[model samples]
Target: MNRMTKTALVVATLFSASSFAGYEVQLDESSKLTFGGYFKVDLRNVNGDQAYRDYWIGTSTYAPDTNQTSLQAKESRFNVKFTHGAVTGFLEYDFYGGGGNALVSNSYTPRMRHAYIAYKNWKVGQTWSTFMPLASIADALDFGGAHVGQVFIRQTQIRYTNGGLELALENPANATDANQSIPDAVARYTYKGDFGQVAVAVLARTFDNNGVAGNADGTQFAYSLSGKVFTFGKDDFRFTYNAGAAGRYISPGHNPGDKVNTDGSGDLLTTQAYTVAYRHFWSEDWRSSIYYGHADVEDFNGLNADSDRNHYAINLIKQLNKQLSVGVELGNYDADISATNSANSDYIQLSAKYVL
Candidate 1:
């Protein structure tokens, strides 16, 4: 074996031996520490439109049948977790090919997606918020296109989770004020039964000027509800669904294009999103899933725009062995814009992962 492999094996052996030795390591019957990770790389061929849009200008749209493209290292992630007594800690990072024209220029920065510590049922650090419960969907590959209700924000927060309920006092990273006046509050409740699990949550935060003068301050609230149905049979299957709504009311004078602003004007902008997915396991070694997602944004006149977006994806997973697996996904995005032609894009991805 290579030097690194040998060293790792030796360390693992020592750790296992130490656990069996007559030493009090404070082993908990209900909690334990574990390490896990996944790595993914994608080769993409862009067609029929751009992958994402630049709202600042109407131009810069990618056209149909672009050159052969490859998005390497699309979604590679590593995570570690520690749990002892009633305390728990976790850290997870992702290295992915970001979407946009600045792809090559954007250096791979280990995105700190989650880092948090919890005592008893209270948690503190940067992690997913309670408001995100309603926006999640089941997909074979998480690295593919926007998963409709998926929220990818990590912020500093103090949270409490008990039974199936959670509450948090969070400072969303999207907040722009230096004084941190806008505090985001979130709550979630989840219930699991023999058949499935159900979750609901709410997120509320104040909006400050994007560190600019004359921005009016306001509050934004989002609500989400989600559920999953698990079936056990010759072939295991799971169905997941989620729906969410978010609205913001901004006062005049503030930069409408702030990080937290969904609309250009300080006026109120409301959005609703929903997702549904189904996964069927043909055997212990093979599985596949298909999903659909939609999002609608209200316009300045309080009317839902015709410019909604829809996403569809299909994914397949294969377990190579006990510790390795492979996955592939196909995704498409469709958007409607006024005056300008509607946009659509399709992508394909493949990934291989090892678990420890």
Candidate 2:
């Protein structure tokens, strides 16, 4: 195919809801191998007290006049897949394992992003949680476009999917350090059509404090609703809303599942998060996206109780070709700890990505 045809094909594939993309090889009549992933580099700077991170985590406190700038390629990753008959195995990794030095030779560790096996309608091993709506995620230059207001997590599980319904039993230990006597249960249903797609998922988990004194444990539930609606030509709107005692599932490291009370009783922190994003294609090679996220936590046991945070991001991306793209994003974040204390920060990021 010609270069223009190749680019168009790649773009169309990316916009599709399917997860199969990349180079493929036929090892035999019934066996196949695929290699995929992307190399991404980001240059970012943050100004103010919100603290700088590869992505927003809402851990910044009241520190003022803080500023930092850095460049990193840790977001680059690759994956391998092997398929034979009705069975498939996939493995993927990224360089977010930390322990890398910034002074010289930024050597970082590679961490597993996914490792799973699929046979028939069953999926086993580590992958994105069923409660997360991947299709509702924002499209932007930031590592996590709506990091502050989304359910983002990955863990080992056994899942079964039939049509639009999905059921899974995931590892609960990853969500809490307390004694876990049962796995996390999740159920999701999605509806897809030419117009767009929508999904709803529910999660149930048990938190056990190992009978420790002054620690409380119990069972809690969470729910999420997400969808992507196509609008005008090549434009779409995506959104997701999550609520309940989601804890780490709400937004890794930002919202905790529960807190210990003075009397040793565990209190499931109530958390709610939501994100809305819109993407408009200026042309076949140009596009722009804008997104906003908000998160709230209540009934906590600290001075920062009832804390909340919000963030906004906008970006313009240019597709150089089928395998290369560049984008620039501007974002702002704010945290409201209490009426007497609040902090905010602004950031700008430039990123380049190449599909392998």
Candidate 3:
């Protein structure tokens, strides 16, 4: 009796599985899709030496010895989103990739900004790094508004979030001789309240490269603190502090957590970065923000070109309509690198945008 009963159960399970495999699945009307992003054009007037911050992440920025003015729309962006049940996906692109070829003078090329999927508190694909907090980023007209203090990084990762805690394993870029196979690791804890949120994030990365400058394989540690505070109606404050092997988290190849030495050893460079900003709303359609950012990198060698810099900016924006806006920002930049050839610059930008 037992054997025959079991046999019948197994046959039923097999028949059910085979029958279901032939069926088709589709998203119902409840599922939704949308496209968005803004069309933006920026006009800039620049005065200063190199080390002046420009568009995007400020990497590979020109250090022209003279002042210049330019107009470009590289910040224009577009994105697509899909939502079905508990799963959501997003894809975003912007034209700021700087395809610096002799051709395409317009520099209008698409670059991936974000591409990821989220399901029930889990995220996968390329997005903001876990070692950085998005809540502290200021709403500035410039592409790299939070230049000095922001731990700006985006990479492929697997992440999980519960309440105020998040953890992720992210892709790491290594070009040295310490060949390794492990990914970068990061964790963060956020505390949210009625007024604002405070988050602390930490990162661990392996540095194994060409062994150049007597550098060897090793591990580096980094951390950041980011927070936001509500002041008045429609007014708020934002700040961020970062330290350690900031690596690409601060800016690609700018100042890493460690410097390779001639002794075939690694020296941990102590770098500190911070930014403070305050935003005020004059009316429902007008607002302004004042921000200051500074980064100081310990010079392990006399030739390091990324030792120190400071940034100051103020922006005034007017919302012309529900789908369009115009803004102007003034910025001052100062850099003292390698204790030599210091430079100072001032910049003003006018931006207009149409949203969709």
Candidate 4:
């Protein structure tokens, strides 16, 4: 065949294969293995409270009086999967592990983010909490982008999924040095349609502190409804509404809804959160995401009173290629402690990420 014929055949083959799902496979059929994930370097500058910047973005309350700038590659992560017959195991890790500061010694370690084994529709081990819907997350630059109104947790769990129904029994989180008598239970239902995706989750947890003097066990319930809509050729609009003890279960650190009261009692604090975000594509290679999240905290026994907060994030991303992309994000967080005392934090992050 002529050189032109060869080029035409290659183009045709590429066009035909574009519909395949993106995944890489290695190893033989007897013991197949797959590896994937990304390498990311983020250059972040904080306008205030340099002392409190966290591996995860600091909430408004963590703000301090200092301005700081740092260069970090902690978001870099990878995952490995092994498949043998009907059983499969997977492990993933990232460099956000706690140790030294990103701006200081930079002696952080790589920590396990996910480790699980799956058989058919059942999975066991630590992974994303069942109380949150990953499908509703916005494609933003922040590690978790104002994860205020979202359930962002990972724990050891035994989960089963069938069609749209997913259920899990997760390790109890005894935050108050209490002996957990029971495990946390989570259930989620997700539906996918031509329009987009919708998901709802329910969580039940038991909290107890063995210590006497107001140390009591409490059972609380939390739930959430999240959905996503696609528009403008693959752009996504996402929203989530969460209420009840879901704060401790989903977004434990984002705000003050850690638990109810300060007495090591099991009483779950009441909180509500709402988030809305939209991602728009200006061109095939460029996109932007705008998001706003609000969380309300009701003071209980002076346990936590950073009060309610609103967070906003905006970003513009450019895809250099399938494996290389870069973006910049700006985030603002406002805390309403009272009418007279309010605090805010601002941040700008520039990142370049290569995924495989």
Candidate 5:
């Protein structure tokens, strides 16, 4: 590469559309901006005792002989990032805000997914929780892929990171009780090597009852260990193990951090969950993933709430190009209301996504 050729390339890039191919714009020497996200359309169908159109955990009324199908683009999202020196800001949104008539126009409202700013080792605002191992989540067409036992959440927080260590003080509203004077605290450490990556995170928080019924406040603690291990070629194994009071972190409507007893004392429920997934590549453009997740809560079963939850899914995805792909997934969700009662639903999803 000679100086003349290098200069020509630079000049061409500055004036050609390729310079902004990745939605990148260099405003100045010290500042740059980029925008990226994906647009996706999903065709889904469910069969069995559940009437829901999505992959939901927990118990529902057992409506036998029911089947439903839906098509939507709610998973489409957009994100923008700006970096100036040591400071960077990012904002993201998806169409899951839940406004629209499905039968009329299928219109939906955009909802915030992530809004945050990072300066050096500090991050502030809303984003994926430090407890979640985003890399270990399964690949599936459903929005909640292998979510039954997964620690999945996004909230406002102030976080600090050094190397693989992350510490955060997150919003406490997601606790079992709404009234609280303290934030949820989390600490995590991650390790990455040639084989794969692993992370361990712990969360501690206090839940308070605002004297509504004279209930006492309580403290809860939880932990998660997750990892992705590379196997042969592009194949890998992903897993997550969690213990203690998962509460809303595992997925709302299913697990509660604590329950108030007749004595007005909070009784923290012990819970455990695990998820395992494997991804195998058949060819350069073809891949398949299979995952299973299970969750159990001790002695906290309600008539309509599940004491146990399980999810199983398998998907085959084909990459059409650098920015386009399609996939199909089959999954099942089981929620146990009690020893003898349970709801089971099976779903199939087909999706196409375009990245930008």
Candidate 6:
């Protein structure tokens, strides 16, 4: 019985007798091993006219919530998937409980949102990315109002797909030092047809300034392009777009000394981003979407040193049956700080979900 438990009981008795040996188990061709989950509880109200500090939750100043309500568990998830033969595997867990821009945390803190392994179209570990084709400004419950150019960063990659092309090899999260010289490489390409889907990405990094100190001499290069489109009730309706750019190289003791320019002594910065979205379903149990995003950061001395951000969102989903659902979201953010100050923030959410 040892030997790895007899090879997992002979692979679970050959996948449960080849999943019923015939054509009567058509719940998507049986051979499945699935267990789903979803639970959300949120009631939030935030506002701002001036006070809005949350800098990823370090919150030093800026507090304005004339009508605040708190309770969170926004991401209570559990998912397990296994499909025999052509191979597939997945694991997901999130218990939501943390601060600093919450992605998931349950104090015991075990965050591995998804563990992957796939075959037949190849894939390996960590997920999300075929370059990330914008799904109409996606909103799986306003994870910070979506659209951070839609590339949810869960790296550790190697992938290939056919039937509309896809290729990837990524691992870019900025090697935050250990003798910095960053370039964790990342590449992506994707294309899917029927008038939708398109993606392109590239990242070569080194800007883990987390250790501050003259911002660690900088160095970052990023590029991205994203897409999505759909017209009329085919999948209900959709339209989406994404754009990106990031460039930096500041060596020379982090430049910036009122030196309005420099290229050899090193100093150049650029950051531009964009996202647009629209979706509508209004049937089969209702749906809705609307999105917008923008970012700009430029500084190479030209004293106007820049920084600007904006986001907008709207979502409503309802499915009240066969696993339940209800959601509502609203969002806003604006920042233009270094040009005579500007700040704004807004949020509202209500959610309920249950899915087995």
* Top candidate when judged by lDDT against the true structure: 2
Candidate 3 C-alpha lDDT tens digits along 289-340: 9988777766643545446667788999999988788999998776663455
Clashing pairs in 2: 214-264, 215-264, 216-266, 247-257
| Candidate 5 local lDDT, 264-321, one digit each (tens) | 5664566788899999999999999999999887666643343788889999999998
TM-score of candidate 4 versus the correct structure, residues matched by position: 0.84
True lDDT of residue 191, candidate 6: 72
Q: Per-residue lDDT for 354 in model 5? A: 88
Q: Which portions of model 5 miss their true places by more than 4 Å?
A: 1-21, 58-61, 210-216, 256-265, 302-306, 338-340
Better structure of 3 and 5 per TM-score: 5
Against the true structure, candidate 6 has what lDDT?
0.54
Supply the global lDDT for candidate 3: 0.74
lDDT of 1: 0.57
Ranking by TM-score: 2, 5, 4, 3, 1, 6
82-140: candidate 1 lDDT, tens digit per residue: 77767788998886425334545646767777899989878899886566543244555
Candidate 4 regions exceeding 4 Å error are 1-25, 49-64, 100-105, 208-213, 254-258, 262-266, 300-306, 336-341
Which residue pairs in candidate 4 have backbone atoms (N, alpha carbon, C) closer than 3 angstroms, thus clashing?
49-64, 218-266
Residue-wise C-alpha lDDT for candidate 4, range 192-292, written one tens digit per residue: 99999999889987756555444435677888999998887878899999888654554546443344546455565577887899999999999999998
Candidate 6 on 270-347: residue-level lDDT in tens? 555566667777887878777776655565324566655666777888988867788887877665544565657776
All candidates in order of lDDT, best leading: 2, 5, 4, 3, 1, 6
Provide C-alpha RMSD values for all models, in order.
7.4, 6.7, 10.2, 7.3, 5.1, 19.6
Pick out the ten consecutive residues of candidate 2 with the lowest summed lDDT.
256-265
